[model samples]
Target: MLVEVKNLSYVYSEKTPFEKQALKDVSFVVDEGQSVGIVGATGSGKSTLVQHLNGLIRLKNGKITVLDIDLSAKKPDLKALRKGIGMLFQYPEYQLFADTVASDVMFGPLNFGFSKTEAEEAARRAVNMVGMDYDSVKDRSPLELSGGQKRRIAIAGVLAYRPKILILDEPTAGLDPAGKREMLSLIASLKGEEISTVITVSHNMDEIAEFSQRVLVMNNGKLLYDTTPSELFYRLDVEALGLSLPHTVRIVRLLKEKNIILPEVLTEKDLVAALLAYAGGRNA
Candidate 1:
């Protein structure tokens, strides 16, 4: 297992008038090579839950074991734990601070104890991994790049450390339609290559449906459902739970009304393939 959370619970402003529970008896396991999506409305504890995986949030009332490191232990090796996980928060591009791309991307490895030469080497590889030419952008300021390029460079910074688990929160936020698709494709390509597991928290149902193999639905800081994307999108009363269905799911439902039933599909490509097969079978 890459990560395991058992009976995890957390409260904000504990023992105060503003006390509010963020997670209640949450439990889940993320296995290696799994692409998991966490979905919920704003303030539903999606972010809070992920923060615990890398020791960003202190564990007060739960058990979490990630990569064989017990998070609830006294003085957990957070630095070591964080070194194996790369986290990109909402608008990760905003986290870029170094004057140059090389400097920014090299920071992670250097901070993790890599030598200067080694850090630069790692930075170069990470930049190429993110699809940017290291030679061309190494000395250039990140602020000079386009929005999408800036986002990729920011991701390269996290990739420099070569984390096994990658967690992205609102990764496609503030991007155009094409940018969103590009970002999703980039993340999809990263799976199983230096990143064995991916945990993404997105408010976009379409993204969650298309990208995730498994889905975790959170409601009011609680894990309401843990199921496949196909099952969650097809079988759940997601709308009633204040969650929107993917556009492809809606299209599938519409086709069903027209007597063209298709199997549960999460992406546009799958929907198209299913429709084609149905039409061909009828013609035969």
Candidate 2:
């Protein structure tokens, strides 16, 4: 297992008037080369949980061992831990502050002790990985790029360090339809090369259903479900847990209600193909 959490729990502002329990005895494991999706309504402790993987949120009342760093330690090797994990939060473009795209992308590797030359090389590779030409964007000020471009550059910054595990929070938020597809494709492409593992948190059920092999559903700061997307979306009453089915799944269910049964599908393309096959079979 690449990560292990046992009996994890956290209370925000302990003993204070505003104290609230954010996580309640949650536990899960993530292995290498797996794509995991985390889904939940707002304030569901989804963000709080993944933060512990990289030491962004302190481990106050839980046991978490990530990449063998032992996050439960009073003072864990955070610096070492970070080098193996890359995290991109919601609206990551807001985090960009360097004078140039090159500088921004190189920041992580440099901060992690890579020499200037090595950092630039990593930056160039990362920029290319995100489908941007390094020579074209390297000299431009990151603050001046378009929103979609800026988001890609921000992702490049995280990829520059070549983390073993990549964590994304609402990566498609604020993106146009085309930009969303591009972003998702870029993440999918990095599965086994630049990143060994992926953990994505999103409210978009369609994206989660299509992209994730495994799914983790959070409800009111608790691990409500740990299962595969096929099982969660197809076999479970997701809405009862305050979640919606993927649009494709919803369409299929609606057709079934109309006496047009089709195989349970999770993508738009598959849904269309299933409908066509059904129509052809009926005509025959």
Candidate 3:
């Protein structure tokens, strides 16, 4: 296993009256370079799980390993571990404080011990990876850019670190349609890299269905189901757990009722063609 978790559990304020259990013996493993999507309600331990991944929260119990190191043990080198896993939280743009976009994007690399020139080069490379123009946006103040531009700069900061694994929680939480599109496009492009694994928590069922190789769904601090997005969305158990099927999934299922043989994938364009095939085949 590239990343392993064996019976992990965490409690907030243990031995105190405000104590709350965040994760209860949760266990799973992610292979290298996999696209995993995590879905959960507001307080269903999603945030806690990702936080623990990058050592933001010290693991209090059970075995957690990433990149061949045990996180449960007393860690003497947290920074080195963090450099292997990049995490970007929801609404990350609100944290940008640098005078220029280049400065903000290079912050992580500089902190990782890269020299000024190396950091700037990494920042420019990452900016291009996120589909942003380094020349046009580098000198501009992060605050002066559009919302989409700010979001890109924030994501580029994490990318500049060149982490082997990427984890994002609710990455598209606050954005207009175009901004959301840009962010999602950048996210989708991360797949198929030889050296990195991408994981994200997304509420847009359509997005998950389209790009994710596997999905881990949670509700009420407990893991409910983990499966392929197409399989999970079509199951009655998912709908019973207060999750709705994506619009395209619902329409595709309706077409199946009329004897349509749709593609196995769950995507809007695929479903549209499947429905058209079913309707047209009916006349023959």
| TM-score preference between candidates 1 and 2, better one | 2
User: Which whole-number lDDT from 0 to 100 does residue 108 have in model 1?
Assistant: 94
- Please write out the lDDT profile of model 2 over residues 173-258, one tens digit for every residue: 99998889899899889888779899999999999988899999999999999999889988999998878999999888888899
Instruction: Please identify model 1 stretches exceeding 4 Å from their true place.
Output: 278-284
Report lDDT (CA) for all predictions: 0.92, 0.92, 0.82
**Candidate 3 residue pairs that clash:** none
For candidate 3, write residues 1-284 as lDDT tens digits. Answer: 66787888888889999988888888889998789998876677888988888888888888888887788777636787788888888888999999999999999999999999999999999998888889888999999988888888898999998988888877877789999888887887776652368888877777888778899887766666778887798764666666667788877677679776566658877877776776688777
Candidate 2 minimal-lDDT segment of 10 residues: 187-196
Ranking by TM-score: 2, 1, 3
lDDT of 1 by residue, 1-284 (tens): 98999999999999999999999999999999999999988888999999999999999998999988999999999988999888999898888999999999999999999999999999999999988899999999999998889999999999999999999999999988777777888898898776889999998999888889999999999999999888887888988778898999999999889987889888889988998999899899
Clashes of each: 0, 0, 0
Where is model 1 poorest over a 10-residue stretch in terms of lDDT? 176-185
Q: Which residue runs of candidate 3 sit more than 4 Å off their true CA positions?
A: 256-264
Error of 2 at 209 (Å): 0.8
